[model samples]
Target: MRYALYFSPAETNPLTKAATQWLGRDAFTGETFPTPEADGLARDTIHELTADPRRYGFHATLKAPFELHPDQTEAQLVAAVERFAADTPAFDIPNVIVGQLGRFFALVPDTVYPDLQHFAARVVEEFESFRAPLSDADIARRKPETMSATHRANLDRWGYPYVMDEFRFHMTLTGQVPSEYAPAMREELDRRFSEFANAPLTIDGLALFIETERGAPFTVHRWLPLAPVSENRKIAS
Candidate 1:
């Protein structure tokens, strides 16, 4: 199984409910939801547009998926995640908006947030030990020849090309959309996620997601809140 480190809101968070509904699958619950209706898009088209993100569920990739290192065990990785979460303090993004990345759509921060970048980098660095070296197939799949020198270097060193300076935090919402359908898709996504548009998104926790096999949907193995016991109690109180 491949494991990924992702940023997802607490299960009770309103954004979690909204995002799961929008994506049509809840990673935490292993439950499927009906896709929201859109005026111009057929239900099948909607499903097709969402197929990729739905499989991954609703979350931002902090550390991309990788198999465990030969020296490591799953239990050790879980313990590390718990320790990391306990020590890390929570923060928030100033604002998030629906934006298109190439042909895909995602929730992206309106402004660059240094704290967010730092947090993601930290996760990648801290978890490097748990990641196995990329196989020949994995390297070929990334197309290192087409990538810039720095990205190729990153891929060799980190096992994933998008890390450190290359990372852009985005919670994907849909797969590649045809140019003809782009405008309408954006409008519908804006409507469906209107309540969260331009809203501050708290970075309160990270989740562990497991893919049972290649091309399988990931499921949430655990949700680790990034707050101390006392602070969490204070917030609850």
Candidate 2:
């Protein structure tokens, strides 16, 4: 089975709920939102511009989508993920606020924390062997023109472009907005998130989402809290 590790905003967070409604269709259910008519309209507008139905919805990818090695057992993968979480202590995410990443909107950190950056980097580096190499066709579809030299190199090497320095954690709210609609989208997102923006959000938990194939929305399989590692425990690969 293929899996992607992502950082998702807590469902209980009001801002997240608001944004979730605005997205209209839950990528998870593929069902359209019934209430909040304005939210549906905004979502439709954003989705039209993006024109990529498959990329919609929320969640921030820490490790890009990858298929696990067929030979590896699920038990082995779960054990590895648990080991990584245990060794890494949970750290606070400071200044989490809604912001635009190009045309799409997301909740991003105010400043890059060394611990989080290092942790993400380690995930990319250590679990890389589990990933199938990106095919030339997939690379071509990525379009080098849309990315920087560094990002292109990352894609070629890591099978994902947004890792290491290019990484910015974001829970995607929309696909991409047209220039004409950018102002309106930004306004709506800011207004929707304003209530929660005043305070800090702590990220103390790690979750595992399992998916079987392409075009599937992963369900949360495990939510593990990051705890202090014992000095005597040696982490095995």
TM-score of each: 0.94, 0.79
Q: What is the C-alpha lDDT of each candidate?
A: 0.92, 0.67
Backbone clash pairs for candidate 2 read none
Off by over 4 Å in 2: 10-19, 24-32, 39-43, 46-57, 145-147, 228-237
| Model 1, total clashes | 0
Please give me the total number of clashing residue pairs in predicted model 2.
0
Q: Lowest-scoring 10 consecutive residues by lDDT in candidate 1? A: 228-237
Which number leads on TM-score?
1
Candidate 1 regions exceeding 4 Å error are: 228-237
Pairs that collide, model 1: none
RMSD of each: 3.0, 5.0
